[model samples]
Target: MNTIKNHIGINIFSKAILMMVLLYSFMTVSARNLKVESPNGKISVQVFNENNTENAKWFLKVNYFNDGKMAETISSIDLGLILSDGISFTDMKLLKSSKPLLIKENYTMPHGKSLQRHNTGNEVVFTFENKEKKKLDVIIRVYNDGMAFRYSLSGKGNFTVQDELTSYSINQETTRWAEKWNPANEGLYSSMVGEKIQQEEWCYPTLFQTKDNNCWFLLHESAVDGSYCGSKLSNKEDKNKYKITFPDPKDGRGKGESLPKISLPWKSPWRVIIIGNLNDIVASTLVDDVAPPSVIKNTDWIKPGAVSWNYWSSNHGTKDFKTVCEFADLAVAMDWPYTLLDWEWDSMGNGGNLEDALKYIHSKGIKPLMWYNSGGEHTWVSSTPKDRMLTHENRVEEFTKLKKLGVAGVKVDFFESEKQDMIQYYLDILEDAAQFEMMVYFHGCLVPRGWAKTYPNLMTYEAVRGAEWYNNGPEFTATAPVHNTILPFTRNVVGSMDYTPVTFTNSQFPHLTSYGHELALSVVFESALQHFADRPEGYYELPDEPKKFMREVPTSWDETQLLQGFPGKDVVMARRKNNVWYVGGINGENIEKNINIKFDFLDKHNKYKLRLIKDGKHDKQLVTDDSVIESADSVDVKVLRRGGFAAVIFSIIN
Candidate 1:
């Protein structure tokens, strides 16, 4: 009887152990399942498995939330996954009922077939097979400010698997959309807090929409100080030969990459966005977030004002101490804060005397801003460097000496592109300059990411299509409207842009547009250090109405408004600083239209004075109105062809 009881116990114990092993295996498999979560909620991705093959099909949904409740549903789009290689498409379709509401046509490579060589090594052809699909993992996170998604693929797969011989292949595609979801719907439009709010009409995905293959991984945002999307190539061989390519003529002239090369294995893990209540703060914050904190150690170094220059407009033409000082005197007379002495004045390579020029500029009661170059082989007009070149290590030494010379700021140029090392170089320059209580302005640089907020010492960046290129050709004139219209929605959201506003006449091009257009830009664009690209003489040539407006214009603002219009079409922006409100509007082509100006932002009880800069019907010159009138509630004005308008609204102090 005892032996029989022992045998029964042994059988029960063995069965229990077997069950435990089976449960462990099940839990391990479940743990690897794909999932996505945001601050608001969780989404469990359903992975369809059939005959050892796994696939996923779902519609990505995004909603804008305010105070923990969904304010509006932003976008929803159907997404699918299928196994495909260079030749064959997998017949296995899991979700046939769902279809893409919007289909983007094939993107045309900008540089034609020549750009193919640029992609030679960097191509990541992900092959999806049963083994790899089973090991796939994905995680996506969305925030009020931005969104990020990451994917990891593992396991083995056979490529070109014939009857006997086989090779391996691998690649993956991740896509998301913003705004557009309902195909029949025209999209959401509303006015919020007296600012005209235009949500994206089409689904504007950030990183994946470039027409240039070389820029396939580059991400862009609509808001100037918003987030960016980027991708890094995974393969080692592709990484080494990675070069960016632009679109060539074979692609339709208008249909190609608008930007430059964005290499992978990016120095920074992801693109950034700067969020704030106002445009300048939003842009400044982005730059501060991406830049090293050392660059802006003390906020006191950053001083706000309009600046006059010798760099871009003069192009190192005014190297003489007498001539440069005369320009500084003009800046002082205008009540402009600082004057910049561009390249060729530095003694290290260009062999010009910096001390005399610095003394002369300071004597005029004006602060001087000098220019410097990164470690490039050529120094100041094709001259070779005498010292081992101005690298990051020695950047501080140069900055300290400039500080001793009483220089308030430096405009560093010719960085070319934002490589990992170059990104580090910019950070180092900002940090080292901060130690000397010096401000910085980057030219030929990437768009601002909000560094100004963190390191207020960094004033502005030149990333827009400014008046400096009017000399290029008539085509530039046509391109300017589109570029300017697009920048505010995209780049301006990032930080203060040194667009060098208010060029009355193009010295190089004889046929210039309306002077009022230039005056409007001063108010339309936001920058900490507003650069008037024209010569002092040029400002004098401008009509008194526009010129006076330029003199009164302020660079930084406490509040901003997108009064009307869309990207690449038209734009009207207004900014508020203290008790005054400055408004600007631009029409792309030679079209006459009436724009309604709303006074809803102002306190109803207070009376205000209105000053206007509008286009002259017969003269093609800007007409000014010093005539003060009490605001009844709102103002409606008519603007002329290729024309713009500016207004200053001030409270009538009792």
Candidate 2:
């Protein structure tokens, strides 16, 4: 990043030559500027000192380049470390800089865009010395489509973090998408020019698109351990500028939500920016790529599949463990793996028969999962607040007990706090639950920041506005069609989401959308534990064709591709499990529009059959498909808008 010029020698004095060599050596020793590039060489990052004058107040600047062209030129965006004892690291002296190193590794995920991916990147490490003689390292890594930088602090005493001065400054005309930072991730996603963002607080991975270059920027944090509170962008006078803000301290350290008295030997979450086209935007796994590897010792017992849950059937005959056992019968009939036992199952009527129910269900080869509160989740049923499990000891005890009872997993719900302590505590729950080989699902919490990569037992997360919202009001259900279409590209792009799709015959939810649309959700939403929000009777009453279709939907896939459509509009997605290909498309708009399915992605020579399921013009659940093609060598179909369509292709000749 520093400018170096070469002067050809014609006639040189001995003293001048010695001075030139000494100056060059000094510049090399300072080494305040460095550059690192991605493996494919599409992304570039440069860090440099902005001052070189006498009595210099040295500050660092970062610049990003895309395809050998300047994309963002951020200046004087200095890092900081402020302590409660009035100590500041903003004016730290650079100690040493390591040479850029290459990193590449292949990891398999239980569920995601693809089963496995080879993550490649290059990283540079720089150590800085503060006035207190304390030291910290700043590590920057660049991937093919993104980059991340973080502060690695190490010490003995509890560090009181008064402030974190990291910053992001981009172009003025960039459009942005983010909600006002809140305790819960329940708000709608709205996009506008930076200036139009009326709320001062902003959600993470807030997306932006440059007005000129067509380059995109998605900003967020990765591997946010328990030592740090959750963060979002603070309001700025210039809409293009954003800074990190933490949640308010519960211990009353009230100078505005700061990371209070905590251990110093911890690394802050990696501040990341993913850049590329919309496809890259939708498919980026940069968050998981930077997180630590699997902490679970035994992943063999962990499995992913569709789950039967009876909590949505308010008026049905389903109740407590008996209802779950009934769902298990459905799971057995469908060949699904598990049935989710909702909260208060331990104390409700027939709850005492949990062991007996488990005995029969286990004999039938169906696993049972129980739900628990995440420390603060209250209940109207027999469960009091004391039933909440917050400590590591509590989790181990309960998980061990459940394991003895032959329970397959636990759904921990209602985590109301985003403080770092709670974040760390939640992770500890997963780590301890791993000892019993139990799958974990998080609910009533923040959007996943790639924790599933570290804790593979964490099968799915429910931070989105999921199916449970339907019981609240019709307004909640009305916007669901569009919400379902938008989530895949937005919330789901980061990790596996628990948007619990497929609702049919819920007496509480009378306003139905489309049967074809509900069927397509078997492909649209990607969750290891796909809990269809319907009772056993609802599934049993279905026609044999639809019943078989629901039973065969794969929870995890070997590959996925976003075929067409935009955010909050329409989406067409294609996924594969082994040799079988499943295509699903949903239209979020009110008007009818035809979507042309492309076949070039399929195998050209292999004979394939197509089974079409399209929305009927008359009723919501009618499978009136007038467009079924069998024994096809190719793939192509047209789906109607405000509705949906689905297809499965196999060897018709076979």
Candidate 3:
């Protein structure tokens, strides 16, 4: 009987030991095993998804300083789960505990770029089961160095939903949420001391629904510096939202995937704040400082001052080269540099020949900058060689031929937006252009990303709401100054903007602003390749003073200053080129006010030539210029109604 009892005890002990061993094995397997080493620091990403759970969660912990210090933690809602009423929540809790969790999921970075392991955290995938029992996969990628964060929700869905959302709980009475989100990092929260914090709400979109329904969301916050700009692969429109959908329809279904769509209301792209300091010029300057130079080998191709003929010069008309050359002559005689041959100049069979146009433009001593669709076919061209178009394999070859043709530069159009691949495409084009010595102009694109420093060949990018709409109405001119004010604080910080300034004549187009406001744009807006987008007759019609000011105005500046203003309100900016300082100011609506102008940047011992442009009483649309000689100090000036001013300050040599 004793022996039998012993056998039973032994069996019980063995079972207990087995159970403990199993538990230990499961705990070990569930712990986080992946480690990311980044330039800024190291972080461990833990992903968790279970069959019984309603949602998937991701947790990021930094293993720096041997102890986690300065670690940031945030969570996102799983796109897989169906909200009770199809309503998605921006604020979702991330799973966390003293111990680690287990997660099993598969994902590929939407863009083809290789994923980097970083200390802040790397890409993570979360899966949620919707009410319909469909699995939705969401990707949360965190960049190192607090640049920004990107979240992509892609799966079988009725609509394609792409948004960048941020949620923060503030300490009430201790912090002001608005101040925290502004350009300045210091605010009520930084100044206050308290235990209980208030919950603050602030969220804005970076890029959304362009003319194409493919939506892109950019995170300009510190978490994801201006690194990734999202774009749609397909050009199809979302019938419900009237926007373009992502993931070209052709690529779906072949990879064991169903067509994915996003169906969430998104905010417009917000000015991303990647740096805490207002002087965060490093990223902005990198475009010029880091990118390779233009493909044109000889600086001789660049005339210091010449006018350009935008193929749009004819407004898609049958006007021959003779008529356009006349305009170029007007610019050359006036000392403006270079003329532009917008798109449709390449296909001689349809409109003009690339080689012939180049010869004519050079004969007139005006460098010619031709246009090319980065990817799409020109509407005017019928027999364009498919190989010459902007396809995956032929872009480099086409650009190489243009370089060989002695083309000064190329204006790339119809880029659309920042898809992961498209972002890389822009960089790729810049890299290739560098190899061939060609200058580049980007249109129908998002705001600049400081590529100017890296790729000096990238002369300009058209992201502004410029005078092109003047053909629409006067309201555009009026609203332009307001938009300009907002831009310097937001878009201009990224890089150069091609606002195609100085449309002196009313195209009788649908415009919202006055003609004088258009002229003022020449100085208020900054572009390396500033455009005079009006008939030469319009410029000649200006009074001698205004005309001389236009003739002497320089497009490129060595330094820039924001005197004062607000977005969608009023703005005043001063740019310096050579020895002259050109100041331009504008108001959104009709208003009279006096501003104190500071000449602090000028040498006190030097005298300056100040040429001021202000609205004329006889014609609100026309600007009158006044010239004066003044010593460096401060000047108080009175501006007219719905008016602004411009000044040229130069060292007067006696």
Candidate 4:
């Protein structure tokens, strides 16, 4: 009897102990084992998934926390590609995961660089196995402002991706700043609620606002240096769910296109979702952070400054080397760096002797930038006729010749597609141009997603409806104010833009605009190569003070700040270069509004001279007022009706 009782008691005690151990193990594994946070702990990210036996095993879900509150709930999404064939990244099981990695880097940016940034982040890799037990990995990185995730496939096999399996859910109402996916993505951006975004595809770097979180979110892809086709968001059956769509036979703009077959062991671009307050949304350097670093061993040759353009002004063209020299003279007088010889230079009837023109421009202490066609010279957007779309030996030949000719840069235009081939071609040119130690400008393409970081020689891109579009008609030019106001938060926030600003000539505008508005663009636009879209008369005829202001205002900046206003209504932006600050404001209202422009952005302890440039209250011309005042943080100013104002502040030396 004693033996029987002792044996039973021992068995029961052992079972109870085993159960407790198992329970403890499960809880430990589930308690946010895959977690990462930003340096300040202001942002937090957690990786999660569903593990039900009936469904796909590897459905990736992400949750984000801002300031200890949940900004995004477990959002059902996958950051993997599904091939056109039977192969898929789903039906997967966990293989292994890397311990969290801390990356802190500080790289000095050359001239025209912003911030000289110190990048800090946390990275982790999650590995999975397909149904056949083939392996793939997803990399997620968390920055102080946002987060990015990408897919990686390894092993020896060819795969053509049919699409990417990516989706995200918002925790707030769906008002988003939407730019409807136009093949030529040069269309203006408009705001719409989430439900309204159904069925319609919008281009990337898309912005979303959620009232619940009081935050802004921007979506885009980065580090896309030839691993996959370019992509945008899409949804068909459900408005609440959006997925990644690749180029199709029915692709708009890059119409009738098909994606390329990706080679083995390739990695995809980072699908980034940047979120923060307006400051984070505007100043977030996620794209630049995720991109490959500069490949050029010596970056001193990369120069970013103001450029004189022969296009965008009906009053200017490369009609002859003499006329071209006239533009070059303006660059010289303004102390600008380069003169762009645009498209018409290819026609002998319209100044085809570019080689001679380059020589003359160089002699005048200004380098030259010539234009070329891209994407097989497609003419759907009034592309240059039979212009050089160099590839293979031809591209090398032209580049070598141009390098020897002392060309400073090349402007490649009309990239009408986002197919893998088209995207790769852009990379090829960037690499080649870097090898020759010359800068390049991009036109007629989608907005840049941080390629400038990879190829530091790449200066600026014209992906916005700039001053050149004023030639279309009254309808286009009339919206200039509203358009300008919308850009700082939308297009310009993502990267630098060449809006070809400050057309001071009144006759140039068929619609209503003021010299104040013209002057404001000098401060508002963010082109590394600011194109002063004015004829010689535009500057030469201006008062000496105003001309000096245009010449001295910078194209690049050390910092930028948004003072006040909303999209399409009004905007006040403050930018700093060295010790000086420039403030610009624009309005789209029928009547003028009174607002306080702050000088508090300056050190509160400092005294400064503030120069105000605005429309005259009773006159057709512009006005200026100068005052030496101790910084009280702000001053009252008026933004004129239908246009805007500009001002500069310089510290007064004791």
Candidate 5:
């Protein structure tokens, strides 16, 4: 009887030991490392999970390569969010990951950097669940030029997105260019080392150069519609670790909630990270790739072109009928498609009235663009045409009147918010403008987030410290040169920028850049309705070469290439419209240099006529020359300090 009892005890002890071992094995299996790679295998995203009884977390590691060799790694990126239900996903467990799926898209964007874009990539969806059994999905896309990820939540009822815990851990040794956070997004970009950056709110499209300077990345978001709030980056928690943050409660005149409140079955905008060299960053269409496809099927009415604007030279010019007609004549003279009648058109008087001005503009066979205040107390300037676009009813009424008058588009100004409500307001205006078959240009507004493709009528947006700043104060004079060079790598990458460029003369203050620099801007900057900032006299007085260049330069391009140079120092960019290529280069430093421009991108089988214009001995003079060249040829042109150049190359063999 004693032997039998001992045998039973031993059997029970073995069973207990087996159960414990099985539990340990199950926990260990839950921890996983999932990865997805770009098509060329040059970039990869590896997700690391730590799942245990004591600790559970999910983060991402982004790896980049150069010449098939590992160049750098964005070490750790924390990801998750919380809803109003008090359920935090910061410690959620990864349930499973889907196999890599292929994504291929071919689309056309007439107003973008490249008219024809191909979005090819691989995507993986990682599913996770919190303790409450609520599910969340993190969908990642890996493209040849970049990568993006977004959080998705699904259910039935409404929920407030209380917080987002997404953070990017950039290496402290990296170099970066970021602007201070502001609703208008009009600020200068400052280049600095990652560790030395101030712990402040930074705007989107923040640029980073790896510690080795072998790779580049631009951090921005896309597909931000009414359902979401626009975001900025903050490093206050830990400098060098930039975390996504929503708009300030003080923005939009302190009118709307900063934290987004929405219903279930929703997804956040893609947190886009475009990575590669300067050429890749300049030519990548990843922003438009992830954006929602066009909602307007009939795109026949949309046209991108250059415009003659009045505000830069004459602030109150729109109120004078004669001045409005003068700008209209300038548009016709320059072969521009449209002329803008800015501010106070409702009270036009001199020589005639607003009706007479519109009639005169139409008689010149040029379309007219009108401006209006965005309304509400968001702006201090009590500009006229206010309160006419606040509601959909008002927009329809106003747009209807403008449409009947044959207006080409409307420039809406003074939108000082990025909250969900303001975001919705922007969409509403776009929708209304499209309904009337009129294009839209947003000024005093937020930067583009792939909206131009979704709403093709969105001609351009003024979200940079553009030439208009020359009229505002003396600060622009000191910063404009470097600012111009940095924009091609930063702001202008994502979409069309209405910089109101090309001013050969002074506004309220003088520009320190040369005439060659001013001429280069007409090519360097891309805008659907490229606004010529100078007055009629400023452009009419230009020498034949510069005037002819401005008159013929196209606003939209079929292709774009970054030949050489660095941010805030200099840049040489080439843009192609059809078979002709327009090249623009700028020297941002305070000393002269020789910029070697290669014509290697041209058709090698054909000889071409190159009309080259460069800065002369003085900041105010320009020199022009013509030559026949082939793809193998290169020109070493001297560029003056705070100066630039522009060249037009077309096939001469034809």
Candidate 6:
């Protein structure tokens, strides 16, 4: 009897000890924190399981250097997705977490805010499994300027993405600058308190400023390819969260499906948040850094420069051959390398046919860009040369014809959709255009998604409410001043913005912005194919000083810096090309003010020669001045209401 009791006691004790050990092991594996930090250690990201409920939920926290210590900028951002088969990644169990890997690389772009870029970040991957036993991996990367994360999935069959449950949650009330959602992405950015924001769709590259720490952050996406449709921020105001939303079924004029259909082993586009000061938002190339490198091996033929555009001056300009030649002449007189012949070229007859116009334009030592309507069911505009780029075979035939005709590039317009098929259309055109050694620009399209890095031939995208609105209605005149000031902080921060800037004369409607303000657009806006919107007569009438400045201004930059100012109030920007720096400033208010100009961006030990053009005593008048200054010097510049100023500074070399 004693031996039996002793044996039973030993068995119970051993079983209890084994059960505790197994429970400890499961808890240790199930709940843990994974972290990655920026190279500079200024930014850090943490991912962890929040609870141990039957349906698990993971959260992310992003911290940045605020005041004197690292502080939380993003409190709790939910990260996950769901598939059509009801496989919920939102309810997942941790499988494994990889060690943080150092990612560093140096790459150069043909033309952008910065030609040379050093990309460095620390990356970590967290693997998880759902109730269905499907695998999902979340990859997180933290850079000095920002942080990004993406989802990866693996399976053996095709799957449809029902929806993404990922969302950004802001803990504090902050000031936000966001554009109302539109397929063409042509809305103006409006400033509002975070609590007052409407529960609606919003555009990417949105700007926000924290009230507590004064930290600035931008929300945008990168690496959006044909496999996924472009997404927008769908605000859930009551919850203080912004969810990732696919296009509506009514998008593309109700043409194709909005949700993404994919094969196994798929990765979603990166959800990027640029964090830090104003300078960090303006000067960072985080967009291109996250995108794939250039796939076009031989990029020698791709040249980015100023262009003389005709559509702004006359809506039907390209239909008349005489007008086409005049625009080409304008390009030559300005020493611009390219001229654009806009819509209706197929109906050319006044001076010559389409071929004859191209011949005359080429004879003047200039390349010409032609416009085509991106035809399908999307737009009602019946512009000619339509339906030529809808199919791959059609694109090949048209691109082949254009290549043989000595055309430099094509400005394909009227995309107006964020559907997967339309996204594929964009990539197909870019790939085909590159095959023929032709450059491409998109007009009436969605905002850029960092595709320029992958296709250098993609020079510019017109996704802003640009100068063309001057021809559309009277509303643009009143809104032009504030709108111009906001773009440098929002839309233009992501990619090349082809605003077609620099218009000095009236189009269909008069501009309320001052002449000085018009001149400043050349520097404030960055585009590989910078379009000069004025007619030949308008530019020819300018004084020698202003004309010379416009003639020599570069469309591309080696470096860019935000000197000072704020959104919807004013802006001062400095851009460098080779050794010379171009500085531009604008006043968004209706009252005149004196702005302090700083030369601290230049070399402190050396002096620079400054050539400045600013508003005179009145808004319509202009004045030019020349001076010499060093980095320690500052100047008080007077600008009229709705006026601006531009300056050229270069080192005084011995």
| Candidate closest to the true structure, highest lDDT | 5
Global Cα lDDT for candidate 3: 0.47
Estimated TM-score per prediction?
0.64, 0.86, 0.59, 0.89, 0.96, 0.96
In order, what is each prediction's RMSD in angstroms?
13.6, 6.2, 12.3, 4.5, 2.5, 2.3
**Candidate 6, position 94, lDDT:** 75
Clashes of 3: 84
lDDT of 3 by residue, 234-281 (tens): 111211111122223222112211222333321212113232122222
* Per-residue lDDT value at 438 in model 3: 69
Model 6, position 169: C-alpha lDDT score: 81
Score each candidate by Cα lDDT.
0.49, 0.72, 0.47, 0.73, 0.89, 0.88
| Cα lDDT for residue 319, candidate 3 | 35
Candidate 2 residue-wise lDDT, 131-181, digit = tens: 777787888898886888888877777768888888776655777666666
Model 6 agreement with the true structure over 1-654: per-residue lDDT tens digits: 999999999999999999888666657765565677899888888876667643488888888886676656878788888778777887777777898898898988898888998889999998887888888999998998999899998767777889888888865477789898998889989887755766678888789887674588899999999888889998855435878899988877888888988777789999999988988999988888889999999888989999998889899889999999999999999999999989999999896999999899889999999999999998777899899988889999999999988999999999878888898999999999999999999998988888999999999999999999999989998999999999999999999999988888899988888889989989999999999988999899888888998999999899999999799999999999999999989999999989999898889889899999999987667799999999999999999898999999999987
TM-score comparison, 4 vs 6, better candidate = 6
Off by over 4 Å in 4: 1-31, 50-70, 73-75, 111-115, 250-257, 349-352, 375-389, 506-509, 618-620, 629-631
In every candidate, how many clashes are there?
32, 1, 84, 2, 0, 0
**Model 1's lDDT to the true fold?**
0.49
